[model samples]
Target: MKVLISGASVAGPVLAHWLHRYGFEPTIVERTPELRHGLGGHAVDLFSSAAEVTRWMGCWDAIDAARTRIDSMTMERFGRRPVEVDLSRMYAGISSSHVEILRGELTRILYDASRDTAEYIFGDSIASLSDDGSGVDVTFDSGTQRRFDLVIGADGLHSNVRRLAFGPEEPLRRWLGGYLAVFSMPDIFDVGNHTLAHLSVDKLVGIYGVHQTGQTRSGFLFRTPHELRYDYRDKDEQKALLVKEFSNYGWRVPQLLEHLESAEDFYFDSIAQITLDTWSKGRIGLVGDAGYCPGPAVGGGTSLAVMTAYVLARELAAARSDLASGLKSYERIIRPLVDQSRRIGPKLMGTIIPGSPLALRLMPFAAATLAKLPTAMQRFIWSQNAVGKTLSSVNLVQPQVSQSVA
Candidate 1:
């Protein structure tokens, strides 16, 4: 069977890797001109199950070696003294096997693992997908056309496959009442391997060092009463909006904004969830954030993406000749996990970006107190929460199908 996967970030590469291993011919079409390798992107967490998936792919060591060694954080509020939080201990509490690595690094590792096995086409994207009952005929923006037994959209929140297969993103998206912006800047603060954050009601500004590039990433997350109007693809408009939102806000924000104009990889998006009831329609299927994103930043999207892509591959392999059955089985297996994951983003948004003044004060205090707790005690506390339960809930079954080329 020939499987066509869209996007090459986390899920696309992971799915391609497993599909190839499971005896399917997988081809990945990535919009980026080249693979997004190195330590350029934002830091993302991989919990126990996601780590296990990486281990299964023999990429765990590489991922661990590339982890962001940010072990501690300093959180400052206007009136209160700065609070110190042991981030390493906090991550330990979240899962027994957890690593925080840059998104780009993780993608590079996954891509490397699958590149030799699966066919890769960069600087191109799916222009249209024609899914008949038996197969999918795909047309690329580069004017290339191909036919595949199956089509999977492993693209992120704004997925081209999802839009082409289902509908426009606006109706299917649920805004989590906030916006997130991130940009790379010089290491002006000179804080190495330590995160610095300024918190206030309805907003947060953070700067963390990227050791590989000798640069820092500044992130701004702020809540809006309603969705803001701007082109999703317009960086200048997005930067201007970010500046307008934080203009009066004092701290290191002014300095952060100074680098915004020149920042090449500036990213801006609403912290929203994709609320699609069904991930599949005919021969085309959706995986990861393409179908159901809990929310960016606050949600454990990286882990969710990794685990789901792996499950999709396993289920598809198991289905063998009955590919539709495989897609349904994949959906059924992940539905419970997906439903639970949806609850995390809203709760985390409330905690991370305080909605009120009291929350602003209490949030940092709670984090500091939690960091001070014993590792075991912290683990117990996290295990009782929605996030921990969700992270540990991924239970993958071994593929029943034989490993033979299709």
Candidate 2:
């Protein structure tokens, strides 16, 4: 089968990997000019099943070696006598299995592993997709056109494929009333080879020294009741907001924002969730953040992508000639897990970044509950967050070989 997968991030390449394994020829299209090796923002982690997929993809050992040099995190109040909470007890609320790495780094790894076998179209995307019962004709932004047996929108929350195929993104988007910004800076803090400090003033400002990379990762997240008047795509306005919001704030914030102007890359976005009533329309389907991202707060974004991709590919190969049934069944099998994960995402974000003073007063209590070092720790540690959260999933099932032809 010939397939077209959009976005080079976690989901698209992952889908390509599994599709290749399943004997389907997959073509991956990405908007960026290259495999996005750098990060848009902060570090991310994979837990449980997602980590398993990393191992299957043959990149786990390297990921482990270059994992975020963060030994632990310190959450501070930033007053003259800062109140500090050790994060050793607080890292759980997400998942037990953890593979902390930059999102871009992970993407590049997946891309490299699959690029030789998979057809990759960089610096482009689909302008439109027209399906006529059999296959879809895809028109690219670069004026190139092609046809494919199937197409998947692994794009993201603002997936153009989703918009073009499923009839716009309005019905599927949920604004979670917050925004996050992540940027890089020089190693000026002498963080000493670990994720050093986390400062919270009703919000979160944190930094980590990415060991061996010779760079530091810094980010801040906060709540916004209504959308602010800022260019959602303009880097200057995004950086300016970070500076405006944190300009007068305390505890290394000024220093953190200082790198904004000179930073080569910056990641900024509204904290939102993508909830599709159904992830498929005819021969088209959706995966990862394009289908059911639990928002960045859930920290399962990457895992969801890999697992969704693996499951989708497996379902396809298993059904043989039954493409529509295969797609629907894949959705049914994955929905329960996806819904459960989504239910947990916002609650997790809220727990990390409280909305009001009443909520802020309860942080210590919540922190105590999260520090239990078991399931309690796992659930509570990942509670309320500011911006995007980094989480991923993996497919645990083996695909059945299809005997019939498409």
Candidate 3:
């Protein structure tokens, strides 16, 4: 069977890998000109199950070697003293014990491993999808057309394929009442050797050491109750909005915005979650953030993508190419994980960022009480991080196909 995937990032490449292993041809289409560039050394943790998937895929070593090594972190409120949280205590309730690696490194390694197996068409997206229930006829923005047995939307929050296959994202999107913008800056502070300094009041800014490179990456998170005025496609306008919101703020933010001027990889978007009633319809299915992104705050996106692709391909192969039954089975088991990941966003945001003055006043007390909190209370607070909750592959019960199509 021939499969066409909409995204080339986390989930799409993963689906391609599994599809290949299952003996089905998968073709991936990406909107980006190439595998993305200029990302911060953000770490990704996979619950043991997701880890096993990567181990089987054989990119785990490269990811581990390229990980960002941060010695420690300090959280401070402006005009107040900084407090250090215990590392083990800080990571206490988290899911993956395998440690965190940058998102870019994970994607790069996955892309390389799958390149020989899957055909990737870069710098374009599907112009239209003409599905006749028998198969999908896809037209590319570059004016090419093709047909495939299945089409999967692994695109992120703002998924074009989701709209084409399912419906508009409006009914499915839930805004978490915040905006996050991240961009690269030259190592102006000469931050050396470790990822350090986390500051949060109602917002957060951090400088992290990127692997062995002398440069550091800065994260700027801005909180807003109302939507801001800016075009997502207009980089200039987006930069202006970022500048306006953060110009008066301190702690090396001004310098970070300086790099925002010329940085081609600057990303500005609302901290939003995508929740859909159904992940699959007909021969088309939604995976990863397109189907269920609990937002970046949950820190389980990469893991979810890996698991999603694995389950999807497994269901497909097990169903003997009966797309409908397989998609339903895939959605039934995956939704519970998606629901858990979804609930994580607002809970983490409520604690992580004190959105109101009253909440802000309560944070330090909460922090101080954190050490004193009973094991039960501590567990409750840490539960929001979405750790140790990833659904693994072998756990999925594959349905047998009475009728073989593949």
Least accurate 10 contiguous residues by lDDT in model 3: 396-405
In lDDT terms, how accurate is model 3? 0.73
Tell me each candidate's RMSD, in Å, in order: 1.3, 3.7, 3.5
Worst ten in a row by lDDT for model 2: 385-394
lDDT of 1 by residue, 345-383 (tens): 999999999999999989987998898888899988988
Quote model 1's TM-score: 0.98
User: Model 2 reaches what TM-score against the true structure?
Assistant: 0.89
User: Each candidate: what lDDT?
Assistant: 0.91, 0.74, 0.73
Q: Model 1: runs farther than 4 Å from truth?
A: 397-401
| Tens-digit per-residue lDDT, 233-291, candidate 2 | 79988888878777888777877776789888788887778888899999999998988
Residue pairs with clashing backbones, model 3: 44-101, 95-387, 95-388
Among all windows of 10 consecutive residues in model 1, the one with the lowest summed lDDT is 397-406
Q: Give TM-scores for every candidate, taking all chains together and pairing residue i with residue i.
A: 0.98, 0.89, 0.89
